[model samples]
Target: MAVLAQDGGLAFYGEPDEAREWFRADRIEDIYLRLAEAEEHEWAGRFGAAPAPAPGPAIGAFRQWVLLTRRSLDLLTRNRLTLAVLLGSPLMVLAMFAVLFRPGAFSPESPSPAATVMILFWIAFGGFFFGLTYGLLQICNELPVLRRERLTGLRITPYVLAKATVLLPLLAVVDALMLGVLRALDRLPAMGWGTYGELFVTLLLCSLAALALGLLVSAAVTDPAQATMALPMLCFPQVLFVGAILPVPVMAAPGRWLSCAMSNRWAFEGLGHSLGVERLWATGRSPLGPPLLDSYGDTFSRAPVVDWAMLGGFTALFLVGACLVLTRRT
Candidate 1:
């Protein structure tokens, strides 16, 4: 290194003062500048030949997944208010469910058909709500950082998957907790583990679909406030068209058509099928059973797998939509 001074004096760098100058040019600045440049290059030379190793394709994706998921989990856990709301929501909903529904709604000999329907519907809605609320605020608030990451070779698929990877487990736990608490409280029937497993799967799928929808919305919106505003618009249709409030057969023609698009409808019907709500309503002691069953028509008659498949389809569609929205936004 070399520098020329204002006075036209030159100094040689990259050498001890007592040693021969390493460079051919001696048009350096002052002695202080020469020493500084020499010190800088001496340090730089140590690392100049060594470039960062590139990770293999699979390993690179796995590494990104791990890091992104870790960062998301850290941010989620550190926000005490957010953490409380996420975990507390199920408990609060459980409390309301506990208060609203009396025990043995699923009791075969003396069933309360109305309570059973409400229970299944609300559980489905709860799963949907949990997934949606968690995902809505996730991407919108991080747009600036996400844009910078995109410039640094961040893959959108892995980036979006990481959000699911972190959040889905939490959703699983909450869904399980919702069922366990309700069952323990006799809000749900004494079904076998297999039945509970089916219920859990249905609820989890419902949550996954909602999560994907929320991610799509989050990626579409520009900020958290917009995301917040989107919630009611996203939710109103789910609540109204899910066939919980009004049986699908009884809903107006357009409402019935829109009900086909709501993931919660599948989930609720899945739960009902898993618990055999149709049979219970048809044969149970409650006089209310037959009338409600007539209103619901064949809603819960289809196999739960069909509903599961629908939920899975919704998840895939929403995920692809989210990815497209994000790619376009970027």
Candidate 2:
């Protein structure tokens, strides 16, 4: 009997038991290099002549997640440039903020209202940038490998989740450091740990949402260059519509509604509310403070949870969107 594999591998067996033993051996020595192509169907025969032993039970999603997370961490840590950017970018931005925004802006006596808002807006934007940059290349660069693994019963859920699991903690740390460093430098106001905690949560969520957005784009694109090309497009709307440059209420009707959709908008407002920016602008000695707050009416009016919920919803939506994109890509 002759067995021909998909890759044109040919094997001759004298009897049924001998053919079964060859299939069980799981070894197909291709007389030629092409013959070495080991496919189960060739050994099984086109009409299912011989059946190969089944693989062990499939791996669980949790196990896959763990393994994937380990591999991802290994890759991230080994890439010194990536590790430096992840940890160093925030500090670099913080220094620029410290130099760019004058001290005592958050001070009660003659505070700089514009400076205050800039500090908050830039801080929020920084977190988003970190998350987005970290995630943008993650999937696209490894897509070939991912596509190959999908045939091995890899679940999209675990794959997407492993990306998140590996990166979110780093984001959390970077965000916390942003707050702590700004406070230490007096770029941000001295506040209770609780207030700092609220700010931290807001920034972390902001990063999470951006990370999800990055992952979605990464999965949709074909290569690293394409992913890089998307950075400006993704970031432009985030900065423009975040309500920092133009307070949402003061924006035109179309701009007003669109601002509601920006994850950075929620994050900025959340940080504002947590820091009591409304009250600061209301009573600060800066002559411009009240006018600015009036123009931003009701933006920081809602509770922080409302903003939190919005950010959380965006993260969930983007992550699920990434999973869907991956499935389609395959």
Candidate 3:
């Protein structure tokens, strides 16, 4: 069988000359020379170069990566509690509050139900605090395991892609639930399909930004205890600086600069603006103020600035930084 293995599909098994059909001619010659030299180093019973392994389907590089990604996602799903908490807690809390508070408190007119739902769900639930909790948790939990898997030849990019893919659906469900509750309570405006698309994009981007930062920290940190200790420091400052509760322009100069560095600031600003909260702020009517861009007082005002742009930029920075750290040789 071993002999037959070397004859057909395994024609290149031990002979460099056989490699010509599979590899470039020059490459075959170079491999042949190396094989010949390696033969000299063979022990009493061993061949210098072991027979080449059998090839399978001509899967492309991306297809191989997808397979790897699917494997990682399968592993993640098996850890149901972790996945559930990571994706479910925020939505659960939001629903609880909507149940507890009078629907009128969140209206776009006063505290606008639409405004409160958008802010708490997207900005507070998914943005700053989620980044702190989920980001740190994902890293502290996954980094070491991933590092071991990577050392065994698994690709980091595929793993990241898989994890991100698994996360998106959960985020979508959360966004939908919150959006549904607000709408059912008559808190949201008569949104067209476009509004749903915009909200999904904004929330997903926010989740990615948080997830990336968490992975970056996980890859960079040496200890899990230290990561746990650091999460609140990362989260609390972000909440204070993101203008969820305060106007960025009104902050002390140092605080303003701090807000510039906080992903939460951009997220809340973008989400707030996208939901028409900034319009109130702009027209000097909102409890919060000095929104990042143009604001109007119309009931269904367009954002003075694009929220997606800020979210895209922040998410890109975090993902790139995380990839760099994850792919670095350890």
Candidate 4:
């Protein structure tokens, strides 16, 4: 046998004349085989010198999360219409509430308990609505792509988390804007920054919990239309049972129990507590204050911290549900 040497130090062992003939005969299979064997050897030599270790699960997972988060953020930013709607809806709500409520609604001298109730409930619900709209279309829109990616080691947790990681910051911005706009428009009472900070934190938690719930619903649904339909179903219950329209104390047992499950209930109570609404109403001269407080029955008397814990619990529960649903579907 004759050894034919290529320029790259790769060699083919055969009769030299036969090798030339093989090349000239238009035998594509022989040419391909020879090239594949050469490439394999090249790869072997390159890898043999210092083999690279495969990434550990933790590292791989982290990398996947980062990439997925970036992709989600990119997608979120590219949709100008959605971004406008998400940011604008809260502003619209702020304007409506500002027009509806007088400036001294929560003032100590002349508190309007009804106004306080509406303010807290609307702000809390605004946060929840922001989060829900942000997350409702996230999973269902990408189900096919996600299903394919899942086959290639894409994890459900990272997918769900990436969606949250991208949207949560936007949600925070929306929450802050909502508060600032309300305060600027005199819909919110003047207060120290510390109290405002507490309120902001409360709203952000509520938004996070709602975002997780939306993610869960998004993961469970098959299409964007279904998720869209779910919006009213989710929001109506949240609106009706959050103890703002009808006090939880006055609701039927089942309705009261259902109110407990609405994240907005905790959010409304938390905002009210943080803003000292109970004190404002209890000591104010408004004739409706005392009776309203009686109906509410210490709804805002608890520490905002308790409401924070409840919101956090709801967030975790919903996220776990979203992950499980994704896992099952994929």
Candidate 5:
């Protein structure tokens, strides 16, 4: 008998006369049955072993979250240029704004409506811009690796949360610095600790919402270049429709409706209300104050808690979107 390999199995290949001599008709069935059994045994030995047991769901999930978060933090720390940009850009923005606005802009005694508005705009949008930049490139840059890991049982929730976990604290630090620096420069008025805490919470929520938006964009896009291109597209609406540049009441009907959707609008309004922009601008000595207040038209009249709720809603919405996109892709 001549053994030949054919289609991943052993076969007998010989001249017709040789094959006829090797196995007569009566024995051929038995010989073929034995050969089939042997092949089955060989295949079972090579490839049919039982899989290893998986860990319990709770333990597995915890382990995955810790590992992924640590890995993400490590990756963030190692990227020096990105880290520098994240920390530096906000400081630069703060410095430029400080120069642009006069001191005591938002003070109750001598408020500058324009200056107060500008200061509030920058604070809210600064946190937003920082969060956006931090998260925009995160997922798209590591999609291939994420895809590979997903095959080994990666969960989208943990993956996204890990990214957020590593960056949220960093965002807090950046925000504190922004506020601290401006206050030190006398660009922002000193406030009670309770008021400052309220402002910080508002800014932090804005950053969280923006970060979620960035991650959503990152997951939906195919590459970092696409995400980078999307940055201005995302930011322009936030800046234009947030009622800072153009008061919401003054916007066209469609623009008015759109302004409601901008997270920055809520954050801007929240900060303004928290800092008494309405009272400051409406009653202050500046002639421009009342007109600006008229235009704003109850924009900041709502409670800061309402803005906080809206911001939390946006954050949840974007995070859900990111997870859905990642699940579909991976």
Candidate 6:
């Protein structure tokens, strides 16, 4: 903590008191600068001789986990307002869809097709509105923190895994709330045990796809503002390819591939299939659309359960692509 000074060509200061005498000589700046250099040298003397960084296996593991956990938690917690907006918007949209298909507004004999269209609308609402919002928010919100963590040696995969873990339960709650609201309005189709099970699986897939896609976008964008603005750019196109508005066959070849890339179309078709409205896919049309009246005629019937296999496939593909991008490219 004390410095020895050179004066008269000799090391002069001999005691702490002697050094203090010079320090109180009205030369505060010079004394402080010298003192700082001395302290830095003293610190170097203590550890600079060591050959290697200290081994920290347990500490390293704990540090890595904490970093990932903290970042993931920060992402969720920081976006409370956005989350509320995203979550609330879906319910409101679903409510609007239900209002459009209120009981007795359509003939009783034609409920299935109408209900089917409404349900697909709800699913797509989940896909476009909630999905894009959640995805964009996750990516945009986490990017800066993620950059900082990467600088400190945190793996993006574990970070993403932690994010997915945190999101699933929250998304489940959102899904449940949406389902309850739709059911309350008698907007949901009645499906049996197997069908409901398939539907649950499909919903989770769609949610995962949304979250993962968001992560991918987040990784690619430098500006949070840009990420936020980009959601509609990514989501609206999904509507055209949803097979409900325009049949898949009517879409050009590129449009067909684009639809294949869209998780929304997959989710809608999967949901329709789960409801036993097999006619939706019989010709690559969302069973929820026009000819909808012909298929159900009036009341709801359990459509054949969705193809769980295909739902699983698309879910895996989206998630895998997300993970790859998040961990490596992003």
Candidate 6 residue runs with Cα over 4 Å from true position:
1-55, 58-67, 74-83, 104-108, 112-115, 278-308, 318-330
Instruction: Give model 1's TM-score versus the native structure.
Output: 0.81
lDDT for each residue of candidate 5 in 269-295, tens digit (9 for 90 to 100): 999888888888877889998888999
Best by TM-score: 2
Worst 10 residues of 4 by lDDT: 1-10
- Root-mean-square deviation per candidate: 8.0, 4.7, 9.9, 8.8, 10.0, 8.3
Q: Which regions of candidate 3 deviate over 4 angstroms?
A: 1-61, 99-101, 106-124, 139-153, 186-190, 278-305
Give the per-residue lDDT digits (tens) of candidate 3, residues 1-330: 122222122223445544544333576445445444443333212322565556555655477578866775786789898777866787676676566555554344555433453444343444445554665655545666777866546666655555566665766666566666666765454557776566656666676677677767766777788778878776777667765456566678998788777765555555555656544444544445443332222212335245556666777787677777878844
lDDT of 1 by residue, 194-279 (tens): 99999999999999999999999999999899999999999999999999888999988999999999999999999999999888
lDDT (Cα atoms) of all candidates against the true structure: 0.86, 0.86, 0.58, 0.84, 0.85, 0.59
**Candidate 2 error regions (>4 Å):** 1-50
Tens-digit per-residue lDDT, 119-148, candidate 6? 664664574456556666565566666667
Please estimate how well model 3 matches the true structure, expressed as its whole-model Cα lDDT. 0.58
For 1-330, candidate 2 gives per-residue lDDT tens digits of: 555565443454356556556555433443223335555555435435545446678999999999999999999999999899789878888888878877788888778888878888999999899999989989998889998999889999899999999999999988888888888888888889888888998899999999999999999999999999999998999899999988888788998788888899999999989988888888888889888889889888777888899999999999999999999987
Clashing pairs in 1: 3-27, 3-28, 3-29, 11-28
TM-score per model over all chains: 0.81, 0.88, 0.66, 0.81, 0.83, 0.69
For model 4, how does the per-residue alpha-carbon lDDT over 108-141 read when each residue is reduced to its tens digit? Answer: 8777888788888988998999899888999999
lDDT of 3 at 130: 58
In candidate 1 the C-alpha lDDT for residue 89 amounts to 81
> Candidate 2: deviation at residue 52, Å?
2.2
lDDT of 5: 0.85
lDDT of 4: 0.84
